[model samples]
Target: MNNLTTEPDMHTALWSLVRNNNKLFSQKRNLEKFRTLLNIISENGTIEDLINIMSIFLYGNNAQKELIENTCLPCLRKLPCEDLPKLDERLRSSISYAGWNINETTDWKQKPSLFELCILACHPNGYTRERAVTALANHYEPVALAIALIRCNDWVSPIRISARDTAVNIIARINTDELMKVWIVFDRVSHGQRHGDISLSKTLFPLLRERIPSNELHLQLESGNSRTRRYAAEVMWHTHQSLNYSDLQALCACSDPYVCFRTMRDILPRLDQRVRTKLLDLVKTKKWAPARLERLRLLMTDQPECMHDELLDALCDRSASVRNFARFHLKEHSDVDMELHYQRKLESPNISTRIAALAGLTEIGSPIVADHAKRWLKEENPRIVAAGLSALPAEVIDNCEDHILKKVTNHSLQISKAAYIALCNSPPLSAKITPYFQRDDLSERQSIYFANLLLLQSRWEAVAHAISFCRHNSKEVNKCGVFWLQRWVYGERKFWMTPSKSDLQDIHRELELSHSNMTEALMKEIRFLLDSYQ
Candidate 1:
């Protein structure tokens, strides 16, 4: 029979060699046989012959097997392509899919021979490059994903966005040690999301601890974004459980109110009376909401020696809520002497002292001060209301929108303008008052405030409308409109800026081609607005 079912000497010899001694590939004779199998694969022989030869070779020493599979098998499968774009789509698809299955198999160590073949097959085509990116992203190896993202960034926008999102996802999941690897990657790249970088760095803070570079965390705590400050405080708190006095001082002095409050609140019990008094002195001048600062006051009772002077002094603070927190903590922790001392500071003749006393009388601040603040919301005196504006809760200012709007009709222009400014601070105002631009009843100040908000949000339609009203006789209103328009064109301090000359020309050309009159009218408005500025 042609098949030679029982007497195929060549097949029997190769199989017997592999079976008797898996290390046979290291011998000169078996090495020649492996080379012959690779040659057959190169010449378009059956893949079955190549697979059999690979099995024999797989049992050899790791180094030699790697060499044959990496160097020889890849050479056998190399495709012929006249151009990258003309590469065979079928080959690319087959190779990419094969790589996925090979990578997932339990015998992955034996599959690099095949995986090398796949990588070589797809190296030429654009489709292969995109799929390679997907593979790199989904692969379990973090280092591999980082390399692929960096390599793919220049491909196209869709590819770039995919790579960036993948990089972010990979970075967020890696271990703290792996995070250091990613940080080096971060330092290597010229650009990445600033917020993302800060976040990743914050997460890796402990890995950086007490090393010379640990001071970098302190710097971030002092000056980075709010998220960075919050994370830095958390990391420092965990890393330095019994924080040194100097480190405590640094944390306590942080400009971010939350960070300062956390540092004082966590360490107050552990600190001596001297350190406690220092923390109390610092908390007295703070202007942030009281609930956060109240935790620091609670710690004062554990150090009774510090509360005597600290309690009396805090009872005289300008912020009534601060005084109330001090009193509550003292009453909860200290003896009667501390309470009477706070009461005496409350009764002092100084207006600030009287304000402080009133602060304690109502268990927070005198309800009367808040009532006065509410009344001053309607006051025509700018200076008096400005003080009240500092004390009023954001919610009260927000709920009193219509009342503040009526104050725009107040006799004094300065007071009217301040009232309008206050309205801009209200969260509900952006919703309630943006529609005022559509009405004819807009005042000069109201129109100006509306225009500023529109400019701030980059609302082009509103900017165009406000520019149309610059022709009104009121120079002040015209000036404000021109100011915001220029700001829109030039960009704000932390927002979008005006385009360059080339960009402006390109936009003007596009506008000219589509809507010539609209373009001309807009350009005319821009010119008039600019002249008004000068």
Candidate 2:
């Protein structure tokens, strides 16, 4: 046999096995090549390689059957059961029918690929997978059984039944050592969705709780995948497995957010005062926003006296939710002048702080917010200008309508967009922006914004503006015009100020000229409106 050490060599070996080319491998040499192939696959092959190997084992010639029994099956048994690759839809459908060909009377002596069969239990093909599940019955190799457990959630009905039944029977009689090996796969599968109401894990949890040792559960909690760690934490808590302060601290520091949150929620309350305080302090330093927010909540409810400083510090947290949470609780608990504090923060060099302060002051309805907004609008920094525009009150906007209108054409799209949005709220200011509709230099988005603003007005001129927008070069703007025209035509006619007969005739004339842009259906609706209204 060739060494098959390099990638191309490996590919060639796998291709030979797949084709079952007897010329390449004599009877003895085939066994050696098969052993080497399984070793290489188990060590470093990707999911594609595994699929290829399974194809050969399941359907390849029986020349290497003895080698597969002694070498291939054992190597497969050790393969970790995790999320499998998605198979092609065409292949899944095709193999489903192929499963029917496996004779029902085939005895165990004839089928030696038990581990391969276990993997096939999850094959994309439903019937093939169901047949795999049937073969997996009474087989308790740790990885094999775990794969069967995963099929409990299979989208197919009979496969789910067969897999669940197999797991139920084996779990009842399976020993602790085998169960331990199955634990990681089992815990992971439990978190996934199921096909029916039957959950073998829920039924088996108490049995696992009794049979699995405490040390093993702790090991799972300390280190594993997110799903396994989370499940371990739940099992430990529900089973009342005692965790010392260090264990609690480790769990609190877990990278997984839910595990950290769950530990704090379920376990922290019952700990001694000193331990809880230490844990809270530890969580306060963690960068995760949810954890920090949760810590603030715990402080507010359990230790209000210690909450004042934390609340003030949290007011500037990078996360908006954290800052808002702190502000909401600070109002009731602390007598500090929040408005004055926010006003001071507006001058801070940090842009985020300035924005947060502006938001807080706006929410508090501070009289000084409008003055700050006026100043921010004139600043060279566009972000500051945006914050000001967003916070600028409706009355303030009405007074500065001209200034706001000029900003709609600003070079900075952000500032222009903010100015456009500000003007949108003041319907009386819509006339000032009507001239902007003719400006060809505006971007597609700005053109659309202006068109939408015109649609908001109840006046007949707004309908005329919609018609004029139809001729704009941008297809999206033209589409916007067509949509609003349809709405105005189909909508209640009496509610809006009716166009004079001449205005109606003018709109009808514009629609006739816009035939290339307007859909036939829309033109029909417009014609119906004009004939009735005239």
Candidate 3:
């Protein structure tokens, strides 16, 4: 110790002790040297001298924190630049221990300086910078919040998240005079309210709801980006607060299903016992369920028990994503059989519910459930109508004979295509739908339907299916298959034909060569159809 002549020599020696404070402190000789070094720095050290000594102990063993905080923190803050790294460490220590209301309960004057906090907030090190933010939030000091606001745009994700979180908490705790300053800081943020997550509607509403006009918040709720709308919903329900019933109802729309679903997840659990049931009842209207795919997923994931009826309705959701998820949940989790679930949802006013139930029933190989699904033919939503025409079982199509005859003409081509697919998909439907072509009331739509149904041989490949269709058991169906094959083979209407001459010849050769599965009647019919080309 006596051999060390310069201040730098002692500084280097002190740093060595700080790094190995616990290990060195136990030895009698090193402890005497460490105490002598602390005494020399305490008596006559420069800002850098004080900082070097203070940081050594501050970061050393746990037993040294009080000496650094009580003996060194006061003199260090006033240092030039405070040397940014050391300033950062100070802020980190402050954030870890500062009381939320230390300003009021304590002398309130001797806390970490706001200037130090602001500087640390802008520090390059993300780790210490986030900790600085936590300190600002805890201090809830009015002035440091500006730095917090700037951090809302932090380049790193977690830093930005921390800044926004602290800003909200600070704003929530500040006085009106100080809180008003947030708008000024926000004004400087690029596109301020237009951005996601950073918008006032999101970052402010939950914390500063009392200051923001309710009408403006509602407007943002309706028109804001998904994140803004999400937060607006959170604020609205923070203390069981709510927007108008219709607005709450509107939140369930599909345009922003993910957001709508999240808001509902939070909102549903908080409603009064009486209103909760009514809220569930309102969702049953189908309009609520229509576009909310995101809602269904979260509901199914986090709180499946709350979504029982909605899950049932979801089995018929217009969105395949929702319906698929619902079916998965029911099949894996619910004891309820597919038949019973389908029958229950069959009468839901939600046309999708009805259609989905029918689809679900048919999927699990349930018998024809045409009565329940037939009503979907008149559903205004084209999706529901399309599902109705196709998702039914084969016998269901046979029983709802008249309804199919009528719906075939008036609905969309998508629906008509669906009907073609639906009728042909079922063997029973093959017999049932064939009879419709002979009807006197065939409109152009009806004409298209019958023509397509009769001409359609395979849902997958046209030429190959045409040959197979010619071999169908029913004579009318076989005759119809031949007629369409002739149209395709001869140059009658090029639009209806898909197979080339070579492909037809190849099929003919293959058919004659392989006659085992080809019944005598079907082979004869195919031979007659092929004779025209020959």
Clashes of each: 3, 0, 1
Per-model CA lDDT versus the true structure: 0.51, 0.70, 0.58
Candidate 3 matches the true fold with a TM-score of 0.34
Location of the lowest summed lDDT over 10 successive residues in candidate 1: 79-88
Task: Please provide, for model 3 over 1-534, each residue's C-alpha lDDT reduced to its tens digit, 9 standing for 90 to 100.
Answer: 888877888878877766645675667886677767666765663656664564464345544444444455444433433143344455446444432222232232454545445545655567757766777887655455666766777667787778788888877777765554344454344334333655545555556667565565566567645655555455565534635565555554424555455556766665565554445444444444543554555455556677777766667665666677777777756575767867877767765556667777766667555654566677777777787777666667767656665566554776766765666653233455556656655555555456556445442234444555454445554555556555554543333334457767666665755456455765675565556555
Which candidate would rank higher by lDDT, 1 or 2? 2
What TM-score number comes out for model 2?
A: 0.63
Candidate 2 yields a Cα-based lDDT of 0.70
The residue-by-residue lDDT of candidate 1 on 1-534, one tens digit each, is 124333234445545545534665678876776555444443543343433444444333453455446544543343221111122233445444434333232243332333342342243345444555554544434454344444333345444455555555555455544444333334333234323323333333344343324555567677656765665566577666545666666676678988877666676666677666666556556666562356445645565555565655666676666666666656765454543554565446565664444434445444455565676555454655554555565677777776665655555666657666666664343455556555566676666655565545435444544454455455666676556556655553345445445544443444344343233554565554333433
- What order do you get sorting by lDDT, best first? 2, 3, 1
Which candidate wins on lDDT?
Answer: 2
Q: Model 1, stretches more than 4 Å misplaced?
A: 1-99, 103-207, 210-212, 279-282, 295-299, 304-309, 316-318, 326-381, 387-407, 410-534
Best by TM-score: 2
Tell me each candidate's TM-score.
Answer: 0.37, 0.63, 0.34
| Candidates sorted by TM-score, best first | 2, 1, 3
Task: Show model 2 residue runs off by greater than 4 Å.
Answer: 1-101, 112-131, 137-150, 154-192, 195-292, 315-328, 331-335, 428-430, 459-467, 482-503
lDDT of 2 by residue, 510-529 (tens): 76677776667877776776
Model 1 clash tally?
A: 3
Residue 65 CA displacement from its true place in model 3, Å: 50
Candidate 2 backbone collisions, by pair: none
Better-scoring candidate (TM-score), 1 or 2: 2
